[model samples]
Target: MKQDTPTPLQEADDSGFAVRVTQSAKSVAAKVLPVSSGATALLFGVVMFLVTFGMVMVFAASSVDSVRSEQNILSVVFRQGLFTFFGIPLMLIAARVKEGFYRRVAVWGVLLGIALQCLVFTPLGDEYGGNRNWIRFGDFVSIQPSEFVKLALAVWIGFVLSRKGGRVREFIPAWIPVAPVAILAIGLVMLGRDFGTVVIMVALVFGAMFIAGVKIRHLLAPLIVVSVVAVPIVLSSPSRVRRIQHFFDGCTEAEYYAGCWQQLHGTWAMSGGGVLGVGLGNSRAKWNWLPEADSDYIFAIIAEELGMIGAITVLLLYAVMTYAFIRIIREAQSPFTKIVTGAVMVWIVGQAFVNIAVVLGLLPVLGVPLPLVSAGGSQTLATLLAIGVVLALARSDRQSSQDGEAPEDVRLAVRAEGRA
Candidate 1:
């Protein structure tokens, strides 16, 4: 049975369909292929590595607690994995979003963040470790609005400073709206009593401003003001005061069992790891010894199981990530990209530093988790989303260069303005 020949209309329709398919394939390739820039690829690889490593660590660290609570041994890690499952796609989707979209939604993003944060005060709010900074939806899910608030604050600050451009040196024009909005964001988190997040947000704002070329003299005044306000706030919390005192003064034998319990145990865990560590999944600290083994104090658990080498490996990964961020920032033609990337760098890397420092007793316990490596769903998702934004910025730079737009030296432009 021979098939009948196609009609002219049918031939025309088939040709059109083939052309459409070709166009679609080319479109997909264009989107997929350009994401392979050295910086973007390095960043994407490093983030995925940390995320996978985090899942392994979270399983190791939370297994004991999970079993003790009579839940499956994989319960905590499974939830973390679920977050990762959702987060990765969100990250990739975010990475493909255009720069103009971020600029257009910058203010609305802040407002949405603020609205979510305010929900923490309502009936849906849940308190954990003394910070009422979470919004819970029944027994299954809890959201930390502060985590996304950090992202919004970074984007908003970047937008504001970039818009100001040369006037970033002038305090009033640069800071009026930016300062109040940032302070409000930070103030909301503070009201939730999460001093750790507050500190990270402050550093994030400062980092963005510095990258946007705000003058040092202008920064100093805000630093003083924050310090002054911070002192009284620290003093008001007895727990905060004890933590500060413990850091400055030695922990007495009695105090060690009291206020310094977590810090002392964390230090012991790190030292116990010696060189190569006790071996993965062999952490003694996770056996009801160290509090927050899978979250804020996860680094100690990392040291205990993987040893100094493992701990250092984690640090090196962050260093590599920082390098990728710097590469993107340096290559970026837009002030907004530089500022956003810098702020995110500070938020992730700076928070990691704070978390590790707390573990090593270099600083008092600040209750901050290691970004992308902790068991917290909110933290992991937020960090991955932020990373996606950086990737988008890097891709934007590459696309700009490919279009033959001469790369502008953002720093040089800022310096020229300063000289003027």
Candidate 2:
């Protein structure tokens, strides 16, 4: 017997009306967003805002130092501005890149990164504050290979993991390829004695693993290994030891004259601004009272110049950016794109919090620049490029949807049994 065919029309009632309204709204969304196309725009806005705000803050924070070093106040800001100019275009170009292009370069990029890191131990290496993480090309140009390596390693990990399918849950085929490479990549960074960057890289790896469906129990081994290796490195330098020992000193007047100098001053600069801030360009700490005013502790200046309100605003911008990243991760069709985008989000957002924690004295001072806000050309360029990859992923979803097809995403389905 043939069952009665269900009619498309619903009987008139409150629930039926709700269903109609929902369907109508969905149809409208399909015509407009088409799989949340707004994510790319949101990503673009947040990146632009952060970069612009960073440029302004860099000018404000560095003007004092620039004048003391060079006759012109705009000297440092101009240099940074030039880089920002270049980075913005690079970011836009990245947004136009295809996912397959990223995949093709993933392995080579990491190999190049590893080769670059080796330069830091060569004749061209430069050391500042105790970490030898930079290489110089004459007096005019310097680069931190670790920054680029961080991005490269993340991309390579994502590429490998995405190809693993259900084997990602297994110890040998999935993790052997990823874990050893990560360790080697991080091991190179460790040779520079830059533990801060290593921490961020670790978070990047962990985030990629989670997105690839690795189990929590499998992560413990790497964490334990990294911690064992990190402790000795942290103690190898007395400056790092002192920074760790007196990190919670609260910058007492006595301590301020000693190891707590930067943290103490950062605290005062932040607290002095209170709710509204001391007003932009009017910070007392910018007058050589605070070290690294424009680099690692730039957040202190943001709080001092713009106030708690301004600091919170910067955090809100980051929060919005992370939201867009989440949307891309959820919607992107390709596993490689999904993995890479998720890793980028983890690195950027996690690094931001770790940086802020240092400023607030909740954690020991580690020389980590605030993402786009800090003064470092190599760091800025590398980070902006990574963000560009995210924008590309954000667009990938819409592009796929407009084609009116579903992605096989067989890797996800193949791994479901492992997830169980």
TM-score list, all predictions: 0.89, 0.87
In model 1, how large is the Cα lDDT of residue 286? 94
Q: Kindly report the root-mean-square deviation of model 2 from the true structure over all alpha carbons.
A: 9.4
Name the best candidate (by TM-score): 1
Candidate 1 on 1-420: residue-level lDDT in tens? 999999999999999999999999978965764354777777888899999999999999999999999668999999999999999998988899877788889999999999999999999999998899999998999999999999999988887777665888888977879889898889999999999999999999999989998899999999999999998999989989989999999666678777988888888999999999999999999999999999999999999888889999999999999998898888888887899999999999999999998888888878999999999999989998998887787777677778986434455455666776
lDDT of 2 by residue, 225-295 (tens): 87887888889888888888797445578776778889888999999999998888999999999999989
Task: Kindly report which residue stretches of model 2 are placed more than 4 angstroms away from their true locations once superposed.
Answer: 1-36, 248-250, 404-420
Off by over 4 Å in 1: 1-36, 405-420
Specify the poorest-scoring 10-residue window by lDDT in model 2. Answer: 29-38
lDDT of each: 0.89, 0.84
